[model samples]
Target: MRKIPIAETLIEKMLFIFTVAGSLVIFFVIFYIFSNGLPVLKASGLSFFTTGGWDGQFTSAWTAAPGQEIWRFGAVELIAGTLLTTGGALLVAGLLGMGCAVFLAEFCPPRLRRPVEACVRLLAGIPPVIYGVVGYTTVVPLVQSLISDQLALEMVRICVLDGTSLLAGIMVLGIMITPIFVILATDALETVPLAYKAASLALGVSHWRTIVKIMIPVARRGILAGGIMAAGMAAGEFIAMAMVAGGVAFLPNPAHGLLFFLEPVRTLAANVFINSEVLGKANMESALFACASVILFICIIFSLLAQLINRPNLKGGRSR
Candidate 1:
């Protein structure tokens, strides 16, 4: 091999420096969020995770220090709502999207794959805000009508929640994320070695069995990574969820749960959006930052959990 020219080497080194600089900007931003966020966290203590209360006025009346109560926004409800909606969305998106991916990858004709892939990509490109609008106008009304009729028949004590319920948020998020799962899974399935399929077929194994026992096992990490990405996307959703999540604060009850499908629920992202209007107010501002910090922590935890779950499969991929 010929040695690189000094100028070319220097140019490559400069490109890497630029990339590192960009990465450090993001790293420092996260550090700043954690730093500004830590003081409130320390002051709030464990109660931050336990208590659902967020009334700073009530906190101030009993305070020893002025401006101290600004740190009192407990993030439990926001955290809970965020998890519930994101989990619900992931469950729906994973089942539907992965199944569709499997079919497209394993069963569909090669002639049909290109068009189908393009359609899925098109769906994925639709903005999250549009999904929210659809959920608000279409999904919420449908849910309310069905829920009202069902509650009338099944339970006497039913209270109808407006359309901004957790269920609505989940449904919107699921639809929004389905295309991602399909795209990722389809790519993964395509990457599976054809020799594996041929060997299983030669052994007289059913196609379904081969897919279940061999192909899926091998592609598990990719599928899992797709699922985790979908969940992360759902958690970060703001515009569409903001439109349909109703932005209410409370731990949902099973009894009132159906109402969650109809009523509005606040997510961490939505809280940040709604509260930003009062950003100049010290308590409200700090509270929004606290919520942001908690959201970041939750996202980090979820990502770690996904990696841990997929560790074996990821290792298997490396070995192969």
Candidate 2:
């Protein structure tokens, strides 16, 4: 091999070191959280995950006094809240973002594309706190007003006493993740071989039909990968969910039907964040670490799903 430049060799070594360091950091964090959290989960037993309420006192020691009952720490409601908000966000973001991506990639005029893409980038750059503020000030009031109508409230059997609710959290998270989907899905669509489009047009297929039938199918894997990433983001969201999720750890009653979305809730990520200040309480801190561990598990699952969806076939191409 030709002699590599000294600068190039140094840069390559630096990159290798950085990659290893980053991976080590991630592994270290996972190890730390699990090591600290698993004991608490074991001590709490099944009730830790199955029970609905969270009642913990700040005891400097690990055990309670001789006549004092142990505090209860449960995550059933938090888990439900996380699933509801994340699933709802995915539904809303997937539909809206995929539509926008398809439009931008296939139909938008060249003149408007730049501006629209810029707008998407701007939206993506906005901080989560700003989204929370907007949801608290705008969406919360809007939902409250809509549910305040006696007929509508009665029809849905609205249980939310205030505007902050699962619906509000879902809406905020949906908006937050939409830009990610739009960017990723747009890129995926744009990457479809130009020959595919040319062949479809030559076959006399309409542009829309070709897109719907050919392009989308071909790009489904990428779209799904984007969705997995968006799901991870929504699942891990804290500030925005905290602001609009009503800070209540209560499972939405499925019997309420559509009004189930009106229930106030709290998510695992938000729970960890909300309870982070109680690190001095041994059991409580361990429980929060357990919550973080659960979040980590969720992220790992999403990552694995994305990897599986993007895995290549034996034919040396991405799986369909």
* Cα misplacement distance, residue 220 of candidate 1 (Å): 0.3
Q: What is the TM-score of each candidate against the true structure?
A: 0.87, 0.90
Worst 10 contiguous positions by lDDT, candidate 2: 54-63
Clashing pairs for model 2 are: none
Model 1 regions lying over 4 Å from their true place: 55-69, 149-160, 255-263, 305-320
Instruction: Give per-candidate clash totals.
Output: 11, 0
lDDT of model 2 at residue 73?
A: 63
Task: Write model 1 residue lDDT over 1-320, tens digit each, in one string.
Answer: 99999999999999999999999998998897777767667778888778875534324534537655455557777788888889999999988997899989889898998898899999999988788878899987766666555554553343235556777888888999999989987777766789988999999999999998888887777777788878888888888877887675656766654454554567888878766666665555666777778888877877897777567534432111
Prediction 1 TM-score vs. true: 0.87
lDDT of 1 at 70: 54
